[model samples]
Target: MAADLEQPVAGALPVKRTFLLIGTIVIAEPLAATILFPFIYMMISDFGTVQERYVGFWAGLITSAFFVPQMLMATLLGMISDRLGRKPVLIIGLLGSALCVFLFGLSRSLSWAILSRALCGLFNANAGVSRTAIGELAHNRGLNQGRAFSLFGFCNSIGYVIGPLIGGYLAKPAQKFSWIQSGNLFDQYPYLLPCVVSSLYSIIVSVIAILLLDETNQGISYPTLTGSTVSEETPSEALAEQDPLLTRLKVAAARIGPRNSTWYCIIGVGCVSLHAIIFDEIYPIFAASAGDHGLQFTSKDIATSLSVMGPIIFVAQLVLYPFLNDRFSSLGLWRTSAAVLAVVYPLFSLLPHISENHQGSSRIVQWVILLVLLAIRFTANVVAYTSISVLLNQVVAPEKRGTIMGLGQTAISLGRAFGPALGGTIWSWSLGNGLPPPFDFHLLYVIELLLALAQVISSLGLAKSQSVYL
Candidate 1:
């Protein structure tokens, strides 16, 4: 399979089409996941399940709920895709996410809402499956894998942009728009519209996948000399079953690839994911909180700020990333981006202070500063995410791509799951304790900076040991 993948393809046109299909399908999960961010604080508050002071904690829990099950299931799902083929797992994940989104919007209580989000996470193995498919497709077709993954990141930025818009604007339609009067579905279920829209988008993408997407697992396509099809596991399973315990361990280790490089890449991905998710989960809660500690922004304001990230990330991933990748290579770009994030994250803590001190005409200046900082943060995010993903694909063996990608996704899911719960807990503790400057709201940012710095250290290690692959 590895030798076959090295051969050149006839043209780029078909490869482009496959990338498009995979990219489009990959958008649904992120869209469904992020659509709740704009309105989630309000949603938790409306549930009346906890004191206003503790809202951040519950909000964080809800945010983390979507990732917890994903962390547990991603590796298994990836391994399943290795056996069952990628298309089926991808479609099932999409459909499950769509159903869960609708259920989440209809949830009237906090427990139900968390359950809905958790189920959504359970259904989403799309991230790993899509990455594996794209990696395989790019390698077999002789396409630039870096460019293909960057395009995947571009589609994700689009979803991030659109999801918040839907959540921000459509969340309380009855209150926002005069036509959406009281006593109707929109009024009764205030957050339902955004979920419906997000769910429908996923369904549309699933339909497209069913019609146009082809199976990229080459093992499934080839026939053996005896006219039976070869499976990804046939050789490995046979060896593991027949060998002694020591040899079985060797087989397992080989399946995981070069341990030092592979584990370093996974850790790098996890750290970046942790800091990114903490920012996403905390930003809105911080913006909505009252007094001097927060920006005290409404859902629309938070949404507007987040919406700006889409264009910045879109341009960064599609235009700037490819150029940077060419000049710096994936590891270099990853290191630089991680260093930028370390610098950029701490700046966010200054925004509330800036808004507090600045007033009237200076309000415009505050908004500008806020947007600029967000732009920088998101751009670094796109570069780091795309580069790390490309490196992950490069480090794994061809037959083990599915399982390895799944493990990578598992690392990301674990970071995402832990980040929100930790951020929310810290935010709530800071507010409740009435602590000093650095220990107060600034604490989360400090932790974020540390995570980014850790990523930089990991990148340095990879640079010394793994640059040969680049």
Candidate 2:
């Protein structure tokens, strides 16, 4: 057992190349999941499954299938990742995912699409595995795990943004492009192009991963038992501090949750993750909905909003996340992010109201405000997510990192699973409730706002738990 404590030095790890490779691999899973967002309603409508009134609920179900496996099997995969090498599991997951995306794009019925998506979910374990691998690498190299995981989160946001961008443009490509061969496969299956593109990337990533990913897991023999553990503060960084803001955080956070420990950080992560995913899945649907009860946004509008959000979020993750984490407690970052969302969601709900009885410059002003708020919201999400991930990884022992982080992944998957499914059902209900113009969608935002506040309360509980302030 003591021999297991001795780890090989990271002297020849090719850290930079490994960073790029793992980041790419992690991006593919999310890209596949998110690429379906913009065209989901259209796909369901074409399937002729249920009434138009239930499109939101059903679209959400298809999306939820991607997460269902994570909730059920992430921990198992993570444990397997510990026994096997991270590289093989990663490669297999990516290759399997590519096939799933292609099948999903080609599905002629809702049942087929659902099965393809669930298969995609069941096959991929990159999210949990990557976190485990990154945590292992950082421990070996004595790197600040926060900055490393921030890059992982940065890669994550890129996938979310680009997936939607591709889905918006490449979906229904036969009509979008005039030069395409008419009456061919593209015309027959309009949404297949984006799926094909995503699948190709997955294939390429799988090949690169085979050539590049080092075996980060040392596979220590656990003959008796295994348990989760939180890594202690390294000599380079101290959890205890004398900063005024941290001091304020200590006092203000006196009643939030339990002490900042393994599962405690996971709880905070679970809440924030749920919030981010709900926004990701619901935004596209809301934007593409008809104006009667929905946001009345066109595909172009949805695309443009995401386009603006992409660079801002990317830059913030690259620049602002590390900068802010250096200055604030984890609880501090969580509270601030939740507070921002609480404000932004209410204003977002106001857009429908702004459209009615407003014209020209007034309408334009509302649009500009919405974009600015959205940008702020995106920045907050990146910061909070990166912060919590860093904390979650920090709270586990290096040897058991895979299983513990996998458990964390399962909790997060529950959020991802619940977010879209519930959001979609409620959205369908809201829009079809026969309420006035803004009231229907307005209810959705109100619910989001309250959840956002729950995040704030959660941070407070964590603070009061007297957890490690980092």
Candidate 3:
């Protein structure tokens, strides 16, 4: 019994509790999002009275709104965690997230939904704080950094897998639940069930964290680098006296210099994220619209098509990425991924065109083309997701990981917010006043090409800059 007590807790945690916490946070939001995604078009049709063409556009805004505040405040939240502790941030984020989920169920108007989404985005930095806490824990246990990140990725991937599947299955039943029916009982109330589930998950995690989680940030009192001329209190003492949350945020942000490799890496990450946003925002709409021309598929078919890419991504991260990272420079991976993405968008544009023009070709040819496009898109996703996060990890120090990740999250959020609006406007324009078949495809290809160019420019810029790690 004494020997059991004497054994360190770290070994036990990675096997059980740590993974559970990470898995809960990762899976809950995505599961909720997935449930809503399949139903989004239905809700927009019922509630917003919008056309099918605009479903993706409006859905993008709503989804992006949920992440905007997270992106905007991610750096600040991370910095705060660095100063005072990760536990408080984790608690606050989970609690706030749950409230936001509840409000989402309660929202009566589109405007109310938007407001609630923004608020949820504001405190959604729980993921970053979790990463920082885990990183610190890993460091203390003498675990490898890459492996730590991979473990975190694995937890999130599991969530990604379960979230969509559950969401698709639960969409209709959630609407009929008694409480949701009594309130607004609209056609889309089914989405409320997933939100309820997510909120409960958050509350449960918060309770568990409050009891079991410790202050893993152990180096808060390291002297500031601004030459001991000023008499600032030690970080630990300051944390003790102040509203530790806000004070720590301010101090950590102040310490982070603008011109460091970390900032450059963040900029690069933001640029890469922009293309991802645009592609993701645009693709579903494009796929759905294919129904109008020659391609036949429902919105659910589109969801399943995209969902197939998730496992492809998992395989790359698990089997392909480490080998690629070892054999080639991170920059090499970035360049290769960008090149493939740049070429593939134009090919995607050709799919519908071939469907219309190929008189002699069998139906199998078109399906084959679509399948190939999905494959290319899947490969692009694998490369981007794995490579960017890995490179970002290498550029920043462990102390600054949370803040930097917050900034990266913010960029992604901004992309989500704006990308759809931009794509919708373009799509709306291309479909304008009776434009012929393939016009939307042409417009999308043009936008994707521009994004590809932007990625290339950013990659070149990254190459020229001195490697922070090397």
Candidate 1: which stretches are off by over 4 Å? 1-13, 222-257, 357-359
lDDT of 3 by residue, 310-422 (tens): 76656665667666765777667777887788888777766666666434574458667777776676566556655666556545555566777667666656665676566
Stretches of candidate 3 off by over 4 Å are 1-20, 29-35, 51-53, 105-108, 134-143, 154-164, 173-188, 211-215, 220-260, 290-296, 353-372, 433-439, 467-470
Model 2, which residues run further than 4 Å from truth?
1-12, 220-260, 357-363, 435-439, 466-470
Give the winner by lDDT. Answer: 1
Return the candidate ranking by TM-score, descending: 1, 2, 3
Instruction: Identify the superior model by TM-score, candidate 1 or candidate 2.
Output: 1
Over 13-32, each residue of candidate 1 has an lDDT whose tens digit, in order, gives 24655678889888887888
Q: List per-prediction Cα lDDT, in the order shown.
A: 0.82, 0.75, 0.60
TM-score of 1: 0.90
Selected candidate, larger lDDT, 1 vs 3: 1
- Per-candidate Cα RMSD to the true structure, in Å, reads 6.0, 6.4, 8.1
What is the lDDT for 44 in model 3? 58
Itemize residue pairs with steric clashes in candidate 3. 31-163, 35-167, 70-121, 71-410, 174-190, 175-189, 175-190
